[model samples]
Target: MKLHLKAALAAMLCTTMLAAAPLRADNEPAKAATKDTAAMAATAAKAPKSIDDANAWVVVGDVKGFIQKVGEVIGKVRPGTDTSQATTFLGVMLGNPTIGDLPAGSGVAMLILPNGDNIAFAELPEPKAEANAKPAGFALPSTRAEGLTIFGKTQASADAGKALAADVKAKLLGGKRTSSLHVTVPFGRILKEHDKDIRDGIADYIENVMKIQEAGRKMGQPPSVTTATARMLEGEFRVFHKLVSRIKTVEFDLDLTPDGIRTEALFIPEKPVAPKAAPGGQPTVSDAIKLISGQGAMRMAMEFNPEAITTFMEGDLMAVLTEMGLTKDDLGTALKWMKDWNACFGGAAAFDMFTPGSKAFGGQMIVRLRNPETALKMLESMPEMFKASGLTKLYEDMGAPVTIEFKKNAREIKGIPVHELRFNVQAGNVPNQLAASMKMWASGVYQIAAVDNWLLYLVGEGSMEEFIDAVKAKSNPGTAPLAAEKIFGAGGYFYTDYNIGAAMKMMQPALPDDPANAAAKAALQAMSDAMASAPPLLAAAFNDGGRHKVDVIVPLGFLEAVAAGAMKAAAAGNAKMDKAPATTSSATREKSPADQCAENLSKIDGAKEQWALDTSQKFGAEAKWDSLIGDDKYLKRMPVCPDGGVYTIGKVGEPPTCSIGKEKGHALKK
Candidate 1:
């Protein structure tokens, strides 16, 4: 089984590499095809030779070439920018005094052995020594230790490097081989070997936290709150540890293909488990794909296993809710409703973001249902279930009173019963502008309708008519479905496509045209132009056989645009810094005794609040110095008064105070 698994894995890896190859037109010349084949062969030949008995390894090809490519892109975006200074700085830091000169096409690799030891080395060119060579301006210690050459700007660093290299017993790769990037991790082996240590580490951490909680309780924290918090943390950690132990191995590869750069990541399970058949049988065409339109700025489609999801919700989520002070009986109706809704789902859901006729950003969600009536029934029962779940009381306690109103059969859309759901929230202590914005958003007509067994939920600035028109267009035979796009043809459990240029263009007009934003606007335009010719960034996850695989393809143009934008921002910052006048050294300035005392009081108050939060103490809870100011507690150490006056840390939600009166500036300004 293991041998067959290896062969299958190898085939999968090769398929990903082949898929990254650029497509050629039918009429392309034979000579061009020959040249492409030769180039690909040469690239494959550069892959590093496999290490003996290696459990894992990572290889990077042409480190210096990648950096130079970025530099070139930056130069094109911002002319007259001096990248040489940056290059020279890197050379000084990574040159002779460290790992020697890293020239163009230099590759690096790290190999891990079965024993968990690893060694990292770079293919560095020999440093040049000349009479007039530029001085590094610092002395370096050079030594030959453990049959390896080591260099550091200081003796301490050199010693540290020697110590790190001491345990590496395997011979390093020394040949003309390279790759863009490759990484393999023996996750199962690592986890198995270090299982006890990991568990012990987490156990020790929880033990310490529990001790802190106990100390807080002794200092007047509520016993019930501390006990609930401890239970929640312990339960969460147990779930996390179980999830971590299930992995077998993970591999990631990023290769420079003829078209661009393609990255493939594989997550293998410890044991192969066949995927369960979809409920209500699989459709020839996914409902999500049918509903999505390729013209959107961003689109996502996913097929889910409701039974698996609900199992997790019922087990893990229910446990968490119980820890949060809710009984299973309290959540019984909601859980049952959720399970019924899941059962009604036809296994696919999709979301698309686009600019409707109104021109503002808008989005819609479409969920395919196998049983629309059951889904509708569960949806209608949601308000009652929520009311019975005690969630309203929780929200009220959090100062956000929420209300849910559902109007069923509110209207008819194309002979289909349309429903309106109004979810209102009154939030307290928020800024006026934010409150108004929230109100405007919450006041929108949240409409839901079942169109041909697909539940359509519309939001944002788009009108119901506009959304309906879009759905109709998918079946009009004139509009292209998102699945028609070449990128989406490779079917997967989950898929997403993003058009950066389109999204940026959508937001461009919203930006104000001011002198301060001139550079930003120019940079944005450059990025948009660069991405105009680039393909949409695509990501997809597939459960092939038993292993899960994810692939992300990024065109070179997209990377170049990112580099250019970063460079433009950096140049703008440099220009501003050059124009600004020099300022006095604030670090060397002294603070008044009163000011220091006030700062100390502020620190004490902050520590008290943190202590209270960790212990889940309500307002007016007392805090002790031992609980709030110890080395392992909230503050690293207790703050002292600059003057001979004492400080008092008041109860939770109250500020600390100094013996000096507020008239002397020894108190925080109200």
Candidate 2:
């Protein structure tokens, strides 16, 4: 991967807070600066005591102290001269003095309560001037003195929204103590001011880091490749920076229940508003989505406002793509393909796919099409297209001629006229090894039908009947349709729900019985037992303003149960440690340390590989000679070098040897 992409990924691993740069403050606060401290104290005091018993707590305040602590721990553990690139990069980030110079009152936190509710907040501080500053590879943006606060309401009820709004206004805006879970951040100004610097620093790192460049060459990529990649991302950065630079604060709320966690994000435009279209002209999602009714352990659904998406893609995205070297003709061709594909199913589309859990591992998907005839025509042309595109040759080279057969009324699926598209890898005139490999491929067959401008494609054999029966029941057992409002309300949404425990159970048979995984297997078994009575989880994400809001709802008691299992495992480990005796090597002294070292050295007669490694391990375990090897008395006494001559340690692969000048040393009996 490019160095820029690696840096971006590394930042993600650290914290999403990197998405929001720090705002600057001019000077350190004095005794008169009671506002920030008072705010923290009041928040802490008013926080619900129940939060202490939460399943998990994530706090992001006091960034300076956090960085310092991280630095100290890392400095202690950092390898001396054998520095790896990852450790070196980490050092660079930590070595930056600005990290330790983050202003006070700059932090964010989230706590998940036992009752399936969560509270999150952010209290960011602006940046200030630096002292004894050295040039750093990266920089963060500064913020205004007056930070912003916002509130999120998870419950769909009007009363909940009202209560949350009122609480936030009273406590945060009015500067009074309130128990609302309101979040604060100066989101807009920081991104706007330092956009250029952020992009430049990132680009510079990707371009100039010699280790990163060398790594690219090792991976068959050219130097400056990461820099070029970062340059391509500049357009996206500019667009995102423009959007975020407008907003002041963002609040997120989630209502977690036994069913799932749900939240709504209302975009009240602060900068400008575009007039709404007439009701007739306004677009709507397809009711064909209702065909998603089915019974399964896994579920996913996605709905989109095609017109709105198309407009954005053709406008802003097209410009960006052009800047990234996509020709206008290429863009036009891609847009045309998308339009043609959409036209096959009218303009609107929704998709639902799921799996029936168990060792069978059967799965299927249903697509809401708007024009069945167009879709059918498109499907009929696919084979020829595959042949024309040389995909047939590709498949044949893999020991298969991709074969498709149509069967009418293959199985009963509700709310659609269906035909089965049975396909498989046919090993026709291929190498023996390739034919053998083809046998391992899973069934490529899928049932297909165009029902009222919609397509139902079913894959896997054993789950088809269950899927049909569930669909005919009229109530989809899956969580997707039940959460339709949550999935489709904010322009568009994507959702996934599954039984993790059941899925893992299905995978158990395939797992290898390795002793290394003994502890993990036990933990998983315990978790599975816990999940027997626990509810399934659902996760979803959608766009709110320029930001993407992600919501995940999991079983309330699941984590607590996992924690209990972990404690049990830890206790078992401690008990084992306490009861266990010392190792045999330590308890029984078969020989002196020098004898062991000599025995290891005597085995290295140039016939064995890694002899030096064995010698080092034996020496390190048996003795701590330090610098005493230089002493004449020690050399004479050392069994490995008893000649009283100078003993020299070998290079990585070579063996250690002793040299005796003007005298012959004892030779090996062999």
Candidate 3:
């Protein structure tokens, strides 16, 4: 990842305010001359009631005194910086002196950084008996002083820094009687437009520090409110209009000793980490994705965390099919089933056939015709294959033949084909809309690879114009579509490769060529752009459904054309992929974490599976479940059944149907 996650993970501190009632002053309070006694009085009045509830309390007292107290309780403020922080302030307050004093809770004691700045410290409350201030509460404090500048060489200028510190100390102290209170965000660093100005200011601010434990306890929670801002600028970021995003939220309260209704903080942290895998058969799919995405995941451990991986299937096979403009029928026709290659789920190609797919992760394939005229003619002529394949109905219904074939293209061996198809020279008057959408310049290739029956499709990087040449070179006697998905799943974004791009470009002017071709090119371009811009992460996430791959919650429309001969080619070879587990590895997750979670699902095994099954049943009706469920090898492989037991939603002969007969009824080629 080019983006260093650590830097991004670093939290941001903004202008979060903690209300400290100083002078009971209104926003428009009158300014008064700086006075040491007044500041001392202010510091003593608002000491926090307890430590555990430090959110609302700002620690106040002389820097030396506050340090001494913190030292007495929590041990010396971490050495290096804290020691020098008190010294800088003493130089300005008393001039040419190091202000280390015996403890007392008064003087320039508190520095506050409150509210939205994004940091909080939960200090343990002090023992109840010793103090009088109410039991406990959370408080914020101001850490920056507007007038403090470190470069003031003159004595008068130095004292001004002192005065600003005194001012912050008084304002940060709320008006309560007595007790110890510590400030949250300490104003230790300064942000200045001038580099020199910034360094000098921080040096001085640190020197005048009032220490009271930094880095509060951070408990885990789903990040309820997620804010995404362009970091292109410093300090200034464009925030989404809606403050809370990604999760539903509600506000409630727990009783913390009343400091009189101090605002409470409740935030849901990042959502339960994205699901990994759920049980079914062998090495977990969740583990596969993690490894595919370059993450280390032990299949043995993840298989047990079923709920954790509920959403982890890396491919949206349905979306991938739909985008490629295919139906379950088209998919069945496209696959190159190898009964012996059971490891691939009867699949016959390695995932690396395409750019993103690989042996372990996953992959895709597509098909094309050697001649569009012949291809269309075949579509019209063999209504049985289309009807039987269930593809004709899909194209007729969706008015397109788009499908997304993803996974690293794995076909490197010479001779084998990845995609194949018959030509329809008749050009069955497909509507202009459908015609424009169907053209990815794939028909030419399909004609070349369809010489063999066992050969579902042929794989190649050559021109479609050579498809006929390829057929001439073919030495097969069987007459049926060739199973060559691995060959076609050769790269990413159909337009990405030189051969496809050049061929398409060469035909660009001719293709939707004149007035008729214009519309086709425009629609194709629009479709291509949308698919190409999807996040890189998602491309690798192509699983049984599109959801596994995208951050933005997308529905099925997520798939689009750019898929075709290529898509069928990749998927045909899906089950054939093989990945040897990494060996002699350094990043293997310690089996320790796995052991800790061993019984997680065991406790709720029956219930969890029931829920999944129940939920699947409920949504199954609405989801066009027949076409959407990839876990079922039969369905994923054969959209139709011979027994006629499942459901018949496809056109006349197509594998029964693509519908489960529940919702959306049956979609057949009109």
Best by TM-score: 1
* Ranking of all predicted structures according to TM-score, beginning with the best and ending with the worst: 1, 2, 3
Of 1 and 2, the candidate ranking higher by lDDT: 1
Q: Judged by lDDT, which candidate is best?
A: 1
Candidate 2 vs candidate 3: which has greater lDDT? Answer: 2
The per-model lDDT (C-alpha) reads 0.59, 0.44, 0.27
Q: Write the per-residue lDDT of candidate 1 for residues 1-670, one digit (tens) a residue.
A: 3233323333422232222222222232222234545654454323223453345766656655544544443454445545544434444433342332455556555554432223344444455564124345421343445544344334443444455344332333343445456777777876775565555545554554555555446534555545545665766776676665667889898766544567889988898576776646554244565664445677777888887878878777776566446676755877777788789985778876654431334567788778988888877877787777656664454345668888999998667777987777786633333454455444445679887667888655555654566566654232245432355355578887777777766565544553434555666666665565555687788887778888887766666666665676567645654654453223312667786677677668667766765554545667788887564778766676667778888776666778887888888533
Task: Give candidate 2 misplaced runs (Cα > 4 Å).
Answer: 1-178, 201-249, 254-290, 330-334, 345-354, 357-362, 377-445, 461-498, 506-522, 538-555, 565-670
lDDT of candidate 2 over 406-435, digit per residue (tens): 565565555555566655667755533345
Question: What CA RMSD would candidate 3 show?
Answer: 28.9
User: What is candidate 2's TM-score against the reference?
Assistant: 0.46
Query: Model 3 TM-score?
Result: 0.21
All candidates: TM-score = 0.59, 0.46, 0.21
